[model samples]
Target: MTDDIDPDEELMLAAEYALGLLAPEEAAAFEQLMARDADFREEYEAWAENLADLTDDIAPVTPPPALLNQIRAAAFGTAAVAAPQPEEVEPPATAPVFETATAQGRGLLQRLGLLPAVGGGLLAALVALWVIDATIGPSLALPTATATLVSEDESLVVEIAYTDDGEWLEFNRRTGRAPEGQDLQLWLINGDRAPISLGVLPAAQTGQLRVPEDYRQLLHGGNCAISVEPLGGSPTGAPTGEVVAIAPIVWET
Candidate 1:
């Protein structure tokens, strides 16, 4: 199989397969070639590993509510499903625990939080092992640290994670939204220093924002606050409106 195709073409095909960008029929053919050619399989695996590195610091994002319907419509050529009214769940009246799942079974964002509501030391150890074995291997340091911000009334909840090496912060807004004509602005509060505006939170539930190299160091041991400001953000270059929620950054170490 390897002899019949040009070496460079085979390498390109391997990369396409690794990225899942090949058409179904072409992918099946590539898989068959991979099974029969040990060298080709190795190339494909290497490509897969290299491509995985590109997303190491990327946070997992929750899909939109209508994504399932769009997927169904695409694959089955069926009409979209009727939207169901979401069941209202009451917020916990007590202090926000910042966790809902067990350490081992949590999703990526929750696992990266290092189990803020649970035993932090144990979960941090477990997560370290998992990250090394599963993703970036041993070459990279633990990629990110996490924190959870909850409003005083627990009406708003957000999970924030930042990577020192990548100089980016990922946010997951678990609940709540900005009030009418207002926006949620994320700010970094480091000691007596004035708050540094990360940016206005997006309407989407989850997203990432780039951080300056100087600001990355401040994320650890510092605090984050979300303030309700005008549509764009605070006009004063600082938090000029009511701060809705604040939380301390929790590092994996």
Candidate 2:
């Protein structure tokens, strides 16, 4: 609600509201905010319009009678009963002229391809582009690097990727678990350079390391290694246990 909120977070909140995913109390509060804030109202309207266009291509489906009856019974403690059909009524003779004019206008628009030009596909693409810009921003075009760390016998394998934020490592352990009393520590090693401790891997076998600016230069074209350490990690600055896996970092344009 404050102007200091992150723009991306604000946009996402607006999108969630437009999707009708907010609870009743939250929706009421958002509506009240929108009423007082013109910019917030505009953001909500844009999201609503884009979402409506994105889902417009989906066909409506009718639920089975049994399902409908069950829902009705749960809500009202009884199933709905059918009522007598209403008698058919005739329309005024002028209805044909209005119907013909409407058909003619639709035919003209079809001939001009205006209707198809505004179809769901284009709207979907626009929505995707908007989301990408909002979340990843323009920095998504930056280059990245990757590598695969493997043990001496090639039994243990871990995938590593480097981006602007930092390096990410993923292991494919059979159990994806660290030793009962030990932790797995990651290291970055360059020729003759002291092994730099990157951090310990999570029990889930996937973790990220934010390379400090001072150490970023040493990470490129370096060797990545993992070693088993004490529960809290290596007490000494250097690795004390045997190196488990090593891989060469490869940069990609």
Candidate 3:
């Protein structure tokens, strides 16, 4: 419905359909067309929002006939009596157009820091993070608290400090295990309160765990515990297998 569009193209389809200017046949064609085209769909998201938003701000004020006549004359030819065509704006520039189902696929790649390339070409994507970070300064450090780790049936306890950021823990692994898939996972328990995930562990003679930030709050409130978990970590966010070594991280200074 826009200028130079022939009252036919898909972009005009969305523009007119969005404005309630499309006939039933044209509206049906637009919906079916949207199912196959990603770029068109992206454009629709941008355009539809604008049309929908105007509903609340503007009221239904009927203008005088002279004003209405002038407006109609300006928009449509004098002989053509139909909805005035609204021009379309450029679509929102989003990541490559993929179905929402692909959102999870996109996230998986992002977790390993791989998504920047697919959206824009490699160089453009690589600069996105740097550009984004430039506008925002360094991450702020969280408040700190102290806790303790202790062994049962023995008196090996260590007091530790944790911050809202996270706690880094190191512990010894028994020597002499062949590489048959032995791995270490870390978990944080706040008494009856639900536990949150701290990531998987790296294997060395001694290993370090970055405990969750919430641990400080839990420990300060008197409910903190830790356990080594299965290789790929707990299947559920909550621990499932035996909790190996446990400690209450307590703050002192």
Top TM-score hit: 1
Q: How does candidate 1 fare on TM-score?
A: 0.45
Flag clash pairs in model 2: none
My TM-score estimates for the predictions, one after another, are 0.45, 0.40, 0.31
What tens-digit string does per-residue lDDT give for candidate 3 at 9-28? Answer: 75776677666575432443
**For residues 15-126, could you state the per-residue lDDT of candidate 2 as single tens digits?**
7777766543344335435534667768877986888798789898976545654443333322133421223232223322221111111111122222112223223432
**Candidate 1 structure quality by residue, lDDT tens digits, 1-253:** 7668555887788888777676433543454465456687789779868987999899999887556555543333233344332332332245223222112222222222422222233234334434432322223356456767666466677788876677679999988899999999998765435778999999999999788888877675466778889999999998877776655565542
Error of 2 at 30 (Å): 64
lDDT (0 to 1) per candidate: 0.62, 0.52, 0.41
The clash number for model 3 is 8
**lDDT, candidate 1, residue 96?**
29
Deviation (Å) of 52 in candidate 2: 71
